[model samples]
Target: MRLTDLISPDAVFATLKASTKKQLLQELSDRAAKLSGLPAREIFDALLHRERLGSTGIGEGIAIPHGKLGKVKSIFGIFARLERPVDFEALDGAPVDLVFLLIAPESSGADHLKALACAARMLRDPGLVATIRATRDHDALYSLIAQRSKPYAA
Candidate 1:
């Protein structure tokens, strides 16, 4: 499925205030919980559990933190562009400025991996990432993600 299908325009944060990996994950988890109708603490704990396994920072100013939760019915996503880069322990050792949080149902196995792959592919495009980073408003960022993610739609 497309990332836009899981992420609403309202859920996109154009100016995230977080400046550290921990804070960024907490903010994303809280947002995902509210959007998924689950408790923020529960979601936060799940994300933390996943992070303990390994850092999701994929480098090039991008990070994808994902979790599989029993409470969710389907995969959900939250995109955030931080106002300042945060030290995310990325593979390339660069700070992250863009974060895509993916939350999926515990039962979704292959689909969850596919979704994460799609997100990583999309964010890896230099042109697309540049456009998204240059976006000044929510609508523009949403539009960019929607257009870029169309090819992966189910």
Candidate 2:
């Protein structure tokens, strides 16, 4: 699945302020609830459950917090660039400024993994991430994510 398949222009946040990981997840869940038609509490709980397993903070100031829900029919995503980096218990112990929250249907299985891989592949590029962080314009951020990201950047 492509990144665009999970995210849209409205889902892209250029400058969100989150002081802590828990608050960030809660905010993401609230945003996702509006777009995904799922309850914010359920989404927050699912993300919390996933975090309990391990931090999704995948390094390079990025965190991809994801979860699955029975009510979801397809994968949905929310991306944010924080105004100030927040501690996410990243593997590299780096505070995260970039975040992507992915929510998928409980039965998605392989499709969910593929969507995660797609987002990870796109944002893993240092050059692209730099460009994303360089602009605060909502439309521009959306454009860069929608247009400039490489299909797979390792």
Candidate 3:
């Protein structure tokens, strides 16, 4: 369940400009719609409902907003680097600038969990996070994420 399995080059946005968490999710949902062929409104509504249960903000300037959709046949991801950090109600109370939005088929139970765990572990790497923040090019960001997500060589 590597990040590459869920995200492609086209799914990476290096500099997304949004003023609030809701705006960020909306933008991500719009992008996810184009990538996943799912309706943007449905995606947005699902994400909002999930957030109402609890904030996905995991601290250290990162947030993983995710949801399941009946229309999706497989898991999909969209990665974005915010142009400015915004309050996300993070547990640490820190603002978020890096976001990974994931959507999975409603029936993908174990696969969805594995993908989420893989993404969370990958983003927890401080070195990779720093590299991602240092670059503003979408291609570079995508390459960094994809390359770093590979299994570590012994």
Candidate 4:
């Protein structure tokens, strides 16, 4: 569940603008469509369905919106640093400025969970989170995640 395996430099956004969660999801959905070759509406629907279950926002100004798609052959990820924080209904009621969008195959139960956990672990580091916030270069942000990810970790 290494970050590098799921994300590339192009998938990283240095600064994204979205006034609301839905708008953000829509924008990401569009990008995911291009990257995954899936329909934007389909991806958006999947994310919205997952959100109906509960907000992916885990607090500390971060959110990880993810879902499984039947047509997906592999896991995909997109990371972004928002130009402005938006209300994400985070558990701690904090606005989300950093986000990671993950899409995986429907049958990838264990692999999907591992990837989600991997992203969570990476984002949970306060120092690293601070660094991600401070950095504005897209490639640098991707590198930070890639450098912090422990490939051997469970």
User: Best by TM-score, which number?
Assistant: 4
Q: What is the Cα-based TM-score of model 1?
A: 0.95
| CA error at residue 94 for candidate 4, angstroms | 0.2
Residue 127's C-alpha lDDT in candidate 1?
Answer: 97
Candidate 4 per-residue lDDT over residues 1-154, each given as its tens digit: 4788899888999899999999999999999999878999989999999999999999999999998899999989999999999999999999999999999999988888888988898899999999999999988988888889866233
- Tens-digit lDDT track of model 1 for 1-154: 5788889998899888996788888888778777778888878888888889988999999999988888898888999999999999888999999999988889988888888998899998999999888886988899888878854643
lDDT of each: 0.87, 0.89, 0.90, 0.92
Scored against the true structure, residue 12 in model 3 reaches a CA lDDT of: 94
TM-scores vs. true structure, each candidate: 0.95, 0.95, 0.95, 0.97
**Clashing residue pairs, backbone N/CA/C < 3 A, model 2:** none
- Model 4, 22: alpha-carbon shift in Å? 0.3
Worst 10 residues of 3 by lDDT: 145-154
Residue-by-residue lDDT tens digits, candidate 2, 1-154: 3576678899999999889999999999999999878899999999999999999999989999999999998888999999999999999999999998999999988888877888888887889999988989889998888885445321
Best by lDDT: 4
Clash totals in order = 0, 0, 0, 0
* Candidate 1 Cα errors over 4 Å, as ranges: none
Question: How much is the lDDT of residue 48 in candidate 1?
Answer: 86
The model with the greater lDDT, 3 or 4, is: 4
TM accuracy, model 4: 0.97
